[model samples]
Every structure is written in C-alpha cells, then in structure tokens.
Target: MSAPRIIQVASGKGGVGKTWLSITLAEALAEMNRSVLLFDGDLGLANVDVQLGLSPKHDLGSVIAGRARLDEAITKYEIPSVSGAGGGARFDVLAGKSGSGVLSALTKAEISGITRGLKVLSDRYAHIVVDLAAGLDQGVMSLCMPGSTTLVVVTDEPTSLTDAYAFIKLLSIQEPAADIRIVVNMANDREHAWRTHAALTNACKNFLGLNPPLAGFVPRDDLVRDAIRHQTPILFRHPQAKASEAVRRLANDLLLPVPRPATIISTSSRK
Candidate 1:
C-alpha cells in the first residue's frame, strides 16, 4: 500500500498560532473522512494534548524510555461533532515528549529512532500533520528537511517575516525543489494578508532565489480565541465563524489535485 502523506506545519517563530492551525487542519481533514494522525512534533514542549484539554498518560518520551510502546503513546481523540458531516470525526494523536528536561536530554539516536517509528506508523493514516517547533534548529530541521510537504505560517510583523524568510532560506538551500507553501495567519484584512505573503515571497525570490507558493491566509477573528478558550477547534466549535470557514475552505483547497510549484490557491482568489 502507498504510504500516508506527511505535512510539516512550521513557523519562523512561536506564537503564530501554528499549533492551532495544525490541530484545526487535522480536524478539517478528519471531517472529510481522511483518517489523520496529529503528531505533537514540538517534542519537548508537547502542548497539543493540553490544547485539546486532554491529559495523555503516555507520550513519545514514554516510548523512547522503554516504559511504554508506541501504541500506548498514541491516543484516540474523537473529533467534535460536525453538523453536515456524516459522522463525528475520529483521529489519533501521538503526544510529544513533555517537559524541558526531556527536550534537552534527548539524544540524536533516540530522536532518529522516534522519526523512524513515525515513518512506520504513518502507514496507518491518510495524513500525518506534524506541528514542528519554531526555528531552524537541529530538531526542527531534522523533521522539516525530510520528504514531507511543508506549510510555513507567518504574520505581518517584520520580525515574523524576516525570521520566516531565514528559516525557509535554510530549508531551500537543503532542498532546492522545496516549494513550501505560505500561510498568513492573524491577518487584519485581505490587503494586509496579501502584503505579508508578497513581502515574504519577494524576499525569498530576490535574496534566496526561491519562489514559495502562497497557500492562503487566516483573518483575525475573535472566534478563534473563543474556541481556544473552550479547548475546542474552531473548525468544529464554530464552523460558521469566519476563521472556521476560512480553515474549512483551506481544507478543501488542500484536498484538491495539485503538484509541486502549484500549491493550493490563496483563499482570497477562491471567493
């Protein structure tokens, strides 16, 4: 059988709602009947479970330490009910290694083993969304550099744009054919979101000679925060909300048949 597709959701810096997008996208895919496994690739920071308001007993650390098997670390989270969807979505979540100590103490061999295990485990799902840690560090690059589709999340902040550029540049050097897609999150308006995408793409083209594709943008909506407060994904919590609708549209766009260098169309043009 063909292996499952893996998508690495990453950002230049933290606090760009990377995890939020990661979880919601997985939820959206699940709603479409695509069995998904959302791996909390933040490894050490492991908060995907927290965001879902779950307290997983076993994590990757447990598996690595030989205290538990990989199956034990995987948790089954039935997605929230969808109104028009056939049935409530159901997917698995592989928790990350919780705590800072585990983060620093992790060896390359251990990480390599975990990565290899992921490759074997991926065969069971339709999609594996890995929420990578921000930055171009070894841990982050190890996951992003592989043969996985990438989604770079960015905002309007100068720092966010520059850092994202720097991160993509490094990745591009390593993988010249990498047509990483850009997602502008927390954008104030259509104009602002397009500008952010343009600025980042221009820098990548002019400086690094790489032209990243613009996937889409998520507008600044209060419903996103409200859903987060309730510990539920907006895709299900308030599907009618602007942010939720945007994400669902993105979900559909992603499911379209397309090849590299021709990523999903921007949400603005789809309207």
Candidate 2:
C-alpha cells in the first residue's frame, strides 16, 4: 500500500485549541471515507485520551517500553451517524502517555524509535494526524517528518503570532521547502481570520522570506466547549455546529492535490 499522508498539527504555545483541531480534523477525514489514525504525538502531557474519554489497554508508553507492539496500542473510536444511519465514521487512535513526564525525557534514540514505528504503521491507514506537543522543543521537532504537511495553529493573540513566527522560522531552517500552512482558530469571522492570517503572513514574508498560505479558519463557537466536556467530537455530537462546518471545509481542502517538493523525504529515508 502507498504511504499515508501525515498531517502534523502543531502550535507555538498551548491553550490555542491545537488538540481539539487535531481530533476534529481526524474525524472529518474519516467521515470522508478515508482510513485515519490520530496519533497523539504530544508524548508527555498528552491529553488526546482525556479529550476522547478513552482508557486504552495499551498506549505509547507501553510501546516505548517494549511491552506492546505499535499496532497493539491502537484504540478504535467510532462515531455513529447523527442521522441514526448504521454507518458512521471510525478511526484509530495511538494514544500518548497521559499525566506523566517520563516520555518527555526520552533519549534521541528513543524518539527515533517511535518515529520508525510510526512509519511502519503508516501502511495500514490513508492518513495519520499527529498532534504535536506545543513548542519548538527537540522532542516535538524530531517527529516532524519532512514529507508531512505541517499545520501551525495560531490565534489573534500577540504572543501566539510572535511564537508562531519563531516556529515557522526554525522549521524553514530545518527544511527549507517545508509545506507549512497556517490555521486561524477562534476567529470572530472570515474577515477576522484573514486579518490574523495576514499578520502572520507579513511577518514571515518580511523576516523569513516565505509566505505560508492560509489553510483555513475556525470561528469561535460555544458548542466546542460542550463537546470537549462530553469527550466527543463536535462533528459527531453537533454536526451542524459552526466549528464542525469549518473543520469539514478544512478537511476537504486537504484532500485537494497540491504541488510538493521533489526533495520530499519519506519515512523510509529517515535514519
């Protein structure tokens, strides 16, 4: 089978709704009939399991400790169709080690091992959404594959814009032709979203000599909080919610073909 598209969702700092976007995006992709796996790549301080209300028998901790195979750690999450149809979206989640800081202290070799495992597991799914830890730490950057599409989530906050610029700058240094895209979350409206994008775009173009295209924007919605509290995806619990609609649009945009660099590094090439 062909390798699955890896969507690495990242942010400069926390509390920017990065994890929520990762979960909803995975669900949206699955709804489009693609096999999806949401890999909680946050490692230490992971909360994907908490957000999804799942208690898996195996997790990344088990895999890292050699107690379980990578595939064995996967937990299936299904969302029944809101229309009461028998068929709905189903996806797998390779949860991270929650409420523990041990994974954060992993050695470089250990981090590479997990990346290798993910590459092997890529063959089983059509797309893998990796929820990266917030920041530019070594652990977070190590998992950022060159062939993956990097989505940097940002808000209108000044700190968010500044830190996002720092991240984009460093990522560009690592991979000059990296496919970095901006995702504006919790915007007031389309105009607000574009303005936010323009702010980041201007900074990148002026300083980094690059202009990362705007992937999409998600408007602020109160229902999102409710879905989080319920440990269910907004697309599943409130399909008609504004946030759900925006996420579906983002997912659809990702499905469209785009030019990629010829020097794109596949997982097999990683040492």
Candidate 3:
C-alpha cells in the first residue's frame, strides 16, 4: 500500500479560500477512490464544522485534554452528488475546537501529543488534507515543517503577495529542503495566475533562494462565494462553476500519479 500523503493547504492572508480548497481537495481525492481526511488545524477559529453544518460531539479540545481519543473527534462527511446521482465522494473530518481560546497558547506537550495522534492515524487514510490556520504563526509553522506538501494560496492584492513571500521566506530559512507550492486564488484570468506565480517565485529565488512551484489557480467567480454562503463546497454544489472546475483540475493533478517512461537501461554489462 502507498504511504499517506499529508497535504497542507495554507494561506498567507485570510479569505483566500484555503478552507474551500481543503474541503474540495479532500472530496476530489475521495472521488478518485483515495481515502482522504480533511483535518481542521485551526483550533481557535475552527469553522470547517460550521461550514459543513456539522456539530461534532467531540473535537480536538477533548483529545488534547485526554477526555477523548483522536479518532473520536473525527466525523465523516459525504459530498452531495453534483449530477444528481446516487453516489458521491466521502471523507472524514477531524474537527477542531471553535472558540477555544488562542491557538498560540497551545502548550508544547499538547502540540507534540497532537502530532503523535496524527502520525498514528496517518496509516488509515491515503491523503490527509490539513487546513492550517492563516498567517505564519509558530504553531502553524510547526505543523507544516514536516514532509507535508505545502500549498500557499495568495490573491492578487499587494498585501497578499507580500505576506505570501514572507511566509515562504521564513519556511525556506527554517526548512530549506521543503518544496512549497503556490496556488493563485481570485485571479482575473490564467495569465493573472501565471504572473502572480512568477512574481512570487522570482522573489523567493532572488532573495530567499527557494523555488516554489506553481500548482494551479482559481479565477474570480461569484459562484465560489455563493457556495461558501450556502456552506457547501463549490465543486459539489456547482461543479460547472469556473472556480470548481479549476479546483477539480488541481485535485486531479495532485492525486493522480504520473507514469515514468519505460526502457530503463541497466548499468551492469549487457549481453
């Protein structure tokens, strides 16, 4: 069996659709027949449950306090069919605590325990999509330091670009080996996305000496906001939406493994 891949969906600025990407990416992976887990990593502002209209009996708080097991905080979610079909994608959510005080206050031991819990549960799912808290806080950076695929979402705004660069620079300083990915959200068009990625990558390369790849981008679409308002992911609620289509394509590229070319020549003496 393949090892579980932890995909960390984070943003430099808030309101960049990180949460939206997290949920939809998990669903897309599940639809591709991969067991996926959408983890809410923002303990202080946990809204994944709210967005999904789920009230979990237990959450990360209970797990942190030893009142419940890690698995106990998990709740299953099945995305509604887009084509009005009977079947749809299903994934699990490890709900975080809402209004649970500042996440920065989480003790070192507590964070360690949470990390262990995640590692233990990793084997159960093919992909773990972590919805990390916005900004570059210590707690958020700690969780992202491991070999997780980090996708930094940014908008076209100046502040968004600046903060995104800062986030990547800090990550590069700490973990120079980390391969960061960029996804431009709310772009005007494909060219806008490419330009945004180019600007960010150029800054990182020139200053931080890091080269983060541009994964994909989602154009500005009112349907995205509509889906958010309805508390449903755009991919499921309106698959035809431009933003949803981009997200689906992003999911496919990330989850689907590319095949290597054939004809591997042997190094040893050939006949």
Candidate 4:
C-alpha cells in the first residue's frame, strides 16, 4: 500500500511564514521516521532553497521548462528536529526554478509528466507537503485542489485577515466542501490567536457557509525570528522554547491518526 497523503500547507498572503511552517512540518514528520517530500510548488518567489541555505543544482522550473529531468532537479537537505523528537528521517525538496522570458507554456503533456512524478513520490513518502505561492493563481489552485487537507496560515492583522477571507472565499467557490485548515501565526497568546480564528471562521460561515478547521496556532517569539536569521528551524534552534513546543504540538496533531477516505473508488464506480 502507498503512504498516506494528508495535508498541503498554504497561505492567502505572502510572508506570513507558510514556507517556514512547511519546512518545520516536513522535519517534524521526518523526525518520526516518516518519509517527507517538501515540494516547492510556489512557482514565483520560491524560497525553500533560501530557507534551508542550500543552492540547488536544479529546480522544478527547469523540469517544467523541459530543461532538466525531475530526478535531476530534486535536492535533498538534512534537517534536524528537536532532540529525541522522533527517529529523524531524511527530507527531500523540489526547489522552485527561477527564469524569465517566454518559457514553453506548460502543456498538457508537461502537466501530466509532473503529476506522474508527484504520484510516484507520494507513494513512497509518508507525507507530501506542497508549499504553494501566496495569492490565487490558477496553477497553484490546481495543485492545491487535489490535497485531501489544506492549511491556511494567517497573521493577526487587518490585511492578513482580509486576505485570509479572500483566499477562503475563493477556495470555497472552487471547492465548496474542501476541508480547509487555519493557522494564526505571530500571535501574542492563544487568546489573541483564537480571536483571529474566530473572525475568520465567522466570515467563512456567514459568507461561504464553511468553517475551516483550526490546525494549530503559533505564537510570535524572538526565537522564531532568531532561528530564521540563523537559517535554521525553531525546533532545532530552540527546541525547549514555548513557540517551538507549540509548533511541535501542531505537527503532532497533524500527523496523528485521523479518518481518511475508505478507498480510491471514483464516482463512476458507484454507478
């Protein structure tokens, strides 16, 4: 049997730490001896490479451009979670490619190739966390649509809240019943974070008739900033810190047992 694919982490606005969450979750899952693949699906402004401080020999853009094969473009990084956190398995990353000019339009054949590669990787990896670009791009939406779980990360600010609502609204229109998850980052405390979530949930219910699940809340901490500056995850840099502990708990809750689809049977099968 293939490994389980649960969630794909994303955000409405940029610079809200969605990428950081993705990296942390990947390491978190890997620490549990679960195979994790962190795919940089955010085509524009891809920074998984920058976050890890590793210069990739190739990137997904190259694969999309037909300039490099998928295997050749993928790079592996050694990310450490908390001490005695878990078994500490390995993590693979598909960095986003950078380019300009009229690259070949992503054709049907190319899309199929990419999807096939992702399915193969998903079969082996315990978790496939796709880091989508902020905003509502059709390409990003297509990639995010297949995810059985979706995480929407936001900050406790007016603009962040607005964007969060906009993102949820768009997704609800596209996939009305999608199980959207919410994460309020940079909060002063749990209460403040929950308030932000309440506002978001209320908006979703009032307008879109949906209530997104609260995946987790991360507190604002100097440790998070410090780790970012040092080019390491907070879990590794300050494992004992409160913010780090919260993130660890977030990861555990996500990786914990949950009911999944009984089978891959399609709508046509029921007929």
Candidate 5:
C-alpha cells in the first residue's frame, strides 16, 4: 500500500486555534471519503479530547507507558447525518494525555518509538493529520519531516507573525526542502487574510529566502467560539458557519497530489 499523507498542523504560539483547525481539517478530509487519523502531537498539554468532549480510556500516555498498544488508544468519532440518512462523516483520534507531564520528560528514544508507530499505522489510513504543539520546541521540530506538508497557523496579530517567522526560519534550516504552507486563522476577510499571509511570507523571503504558499484561511466567526465552548466540531455544530466552509475549502486544497514523496519523521536525528 502507498504511504499515507502526513499533514502536520503547527503554530508559533498557543491560543491561535491550532487544535481547532486540526480537528475540523480531519473531519473535512473524512467527509471527502478519505480515512483520516487525527493524532494530537501536543504531548505536554494535549486538549484535543477535551475540545471534542471525548473521554477515551486510553491515550498516548498508555502507549508510551506500555499500558496499551498504539492502535488500542485510538478513539473513533462519528457525526451522524442530520437527515437520518445512513451516510455521515467519521474519523479516528489518537488522543494525548492532558497535563500528564509524560511528554515533558520524553527521551529521544520514546519519541522515535511514537514516530515508528505512526509509520506502521500509515498503511491503514490515507491521511494522518498531526496537530503539533505550539512554538518551535523539540516536540514540534522533531515531527516535521521533509516529505510531509506542514501547515503553520497564524493570525493577524504582530506577535503571531513574529513567532510564526521564527518557526518557519527554524524549519527551513532543519528541513530545507520541507513543504511548509501558511494558514491564516481568525481572519477578518480574504483581503485581511492575504495581508497576514504576506507579512509572514515577506519575512520568510527576506530572511529565510523561502516563500511558503498560503494553504487557506479561516474567517473570524462567532460560531467557532461557540462550537469550541460546547466541545463540538464547527462542521458538525454549524455546518453553514463561515469557519466550517473555510475548513472544507482548505481540506479540498490538501486533497491535491503532494509534490513530494511521503516520509515519516526521524526524531532521533533532530538535535
């Protein structure tokens, strides 16, 4: 079987809606008939399960601690059809143990183990969406392989732009040929989104000499906040919401053929 498309969603800072985008993007891809697994790569303080209102008995910590197999920790989430039809969207989630501190002290060997597990699991699904931890920490940098697409989520704030540049600068140095793309979340409009994208891209072009293209942008929508508050995916909670529509478009763009071969991360080599 062919290798799965590994899309790593990351950000320079927290509170930029990185996890939310990751969840919805996975759902959107699932809706397109591709089997997807949303792996919460935020090892230190994961909240993907909490945001989705899931109470999984097993999590990443279980696998790391030898309490369960990697596959055993997976929790399946399904959205029933509103019209009572048989068809609906569903995807699997490999949740992380929130506030467990297991990730904080994880050795390189343990990280490599998780990376190998993901490679083994790649055969079963067409896509693996890894929502990485915020900032350019070891956890985030280790998982950013060369062959996978990396979507850097940023907002209109100056701080967001600065930190995003820092991430891109480092990633470009580490994986010079990495497929890095920009995603503007909480944008005011298309124009506003482009401006935000330009700020990051210009900085990259000038300093890093690399211009990451814009993957897409999500508009600032109140419904997004409501969905997060209720621990429901925006696509399921408000299918007609602007944010939901934007995510669908982003997913569609991602479905296009990747320009490079798919490869897993080598955490051991990341210094």
Candidate 6:
C-alpha cells in the first residue's frame, strides 16, 4: 500500500499558528526520516514560503495564470541540518494566484488536478501536510473536504472557542465525511486545552450533530512568537519548550491511524 497520506491542519481564526505548526510538523516528520511535503493551501494568505525563508521564482500564480502547468509552479526546499550533513523535506507550495481576482476558482477538474499533484508529491514523501487559511473560506473548505482529516485549531479564550465551534459547524454541514481534529493553541496546560476542545465539540454535537475528534493540543509559549519574529519554526528554535513538545506529540498523534467512525453520532455529546 502507499505510504499513509493523512491530515490537513486549519483553524477558524487567523494567527492561531497553523502555518507554524505545519512547518514544524514537516520538520518533525523529516527528523523521523519520513519524507514530508508542506502544501501551502492558503492560496489567499500564503506565507509558508516566507516561513521557510526561501523566495521561489514561481508560485501557484503561474499555474492559475495558465502560463505554467501545476508541475512547473512547484518549488522544492532542501532544508539543511545543523550538522555539516544537510537533508530536509521537499516543500511544494501553491501560493495562490498573483492577482487579487479569484484566479483558478477550485473547479472540480482543477481540484482533481491539485489533489493528483499532491499525490504525486506524496509518492515521493511520506506525509503531505496542508496549511489552510484561517476561517471557513471557500478556497480553504473546498480542499478540506470530508475525505480529508481536518484539524481545527483554537485558543482558550471565549471568542476562539465560539469561533471554533462555528467553524466546525459550518464545515460539518457542508462536508459530513470531514473528520474534525481539534487542537487548542495558547493553552496553559493539556487539561485547559482539552476543556476548550470539549466545549467546542460538545456544542457541535449538540446543535449540529457532529462529533469532532481530539487530535492534539499546543500550549502557550513566548518562544513561538520569538521564533515567528525570527522567521524560524519553534521546533527548530526551541524543541524542548512546552509548546514545541506539544507540537511534536501532535505530529505523532496525527500520524497515528484513526479508524473511520460509524455514521451514527450520539446526541448527548452534541450539546
């Protein structure tokens, strides 16, 4: 069988560190000798290229403009290691169209093309992690369908909680097959993060009849902001930090095999 192709990380609100986590997870998978490709699915607010500190000659713009095919627009990153020997995962980014207009509005044919492109990359790599745009944007949702594992990120605040629920609710209605993965960022501890997820999941189950799964949680840490300012991922900057550990654990958790849930979802958990 082909190497496990699973997971696509997203959040209801921006600045929830989705991009950072995607980059870090890519690195983590690479460290484990698992080839990974971090797809910049956030066509509108594409920043995975910046986070990697590399400027590509082309982006998804080339593909959308029809000037270049999907294969031509692809960029590769050869991330060097700390030791003299350097090897890292190859990052393929789809940085959206250059113009503001809805370039290549994800038609079924185009969507199939993109998914096939990702599979091609996955054949060479073990995991393909997509960094989605914040909120329930159409461009984001179109790619994060029920067939894909959707990781919804949130914070401990009330606004984040409510927004997380709303985001999942919207998605659950549009894509019933979507497996919701919850990860609470900027939490004080695992318990706090779990509480945040429980609240949001309960609300989704109660009102929308959707039961999202608990994937992982990332704690609050100053080092995350520091790494972002430095244009480096926390996993590379401070792997020992609480948040870093959480992200590492998250990578493993996401990699774990999750059996498909039965169609029936309990109403008690919905509320």
Candidate 5 residue 138 Cα shift, in angstroms, is 1.5
lDDT of 3: 0.78
Q: Write the per-residue lDDT of candidate 6 for residues 154-231, one digit (tens) a residue.
A: 877777778778778777767766677787888888788778878887777678777677778887889988877876
Tens digit of per-residue lDDT, candidate 4, span 6-35: 566778789898998888878777777777
Can you give the lDDT of residue 254 in candidate 6? 64
Query: Alpha-carbon error at 186 in model 3, in Å?
Result: 0.8
Q: List clashing residue pairs in candidate 1.
A: none
Between candidates 4 and 5, the one scoring higher on lDDT is: 5
Q: Per-residue lDDT tens digits of candidate 5, residues 138-160?
A: 86787665567889999989989
- Across 145-167, the per-residue lDDT of candidate 1 in tens digits comes to 37777889999898889889888
lDDT of 3 by residue, 1-271 (tens): 1232888888878888888888878877887889988889885587888787678888887787778999988988877554645347789999888756655579766777777778788889888999988887887777673766788999888888888998887776566556578999989999999999888877776666566777899999999888878877677788799988888888877755643212112313211
Residue 8 lDDT in candidate 6: 82
TM accuracy, model 5: 0.91
Residue 197 error for model 3, in Å? 0.8
List the candidates ranked by lDDT, beginning with the highest: 2, 5, 1, 3, 4, 6
**lDDT, residue 119, candidate 5:** 84
lDDT (C-alpha, whole model) for all candidates: 0.79, 0.88, 0.78, 0.73, 0.85, 0.70
lDDT over C-alpha atoms for residue 45 of model 5 = 89
Worst 10 residues of 6 by lDDT: 84-93
Return whichever of 3 and 4 wins on TM-score. Answer: 3
The lDDT of model 6 is: 0.70
Better of 2 and 4 by lDDT: 2
> Runs in model 5 with CA error above 4 Å?
1-4, 80-87, 258-271
TM-score of each: 0.89, 0.92, 0.89, 0.84, 0.91, 0.84
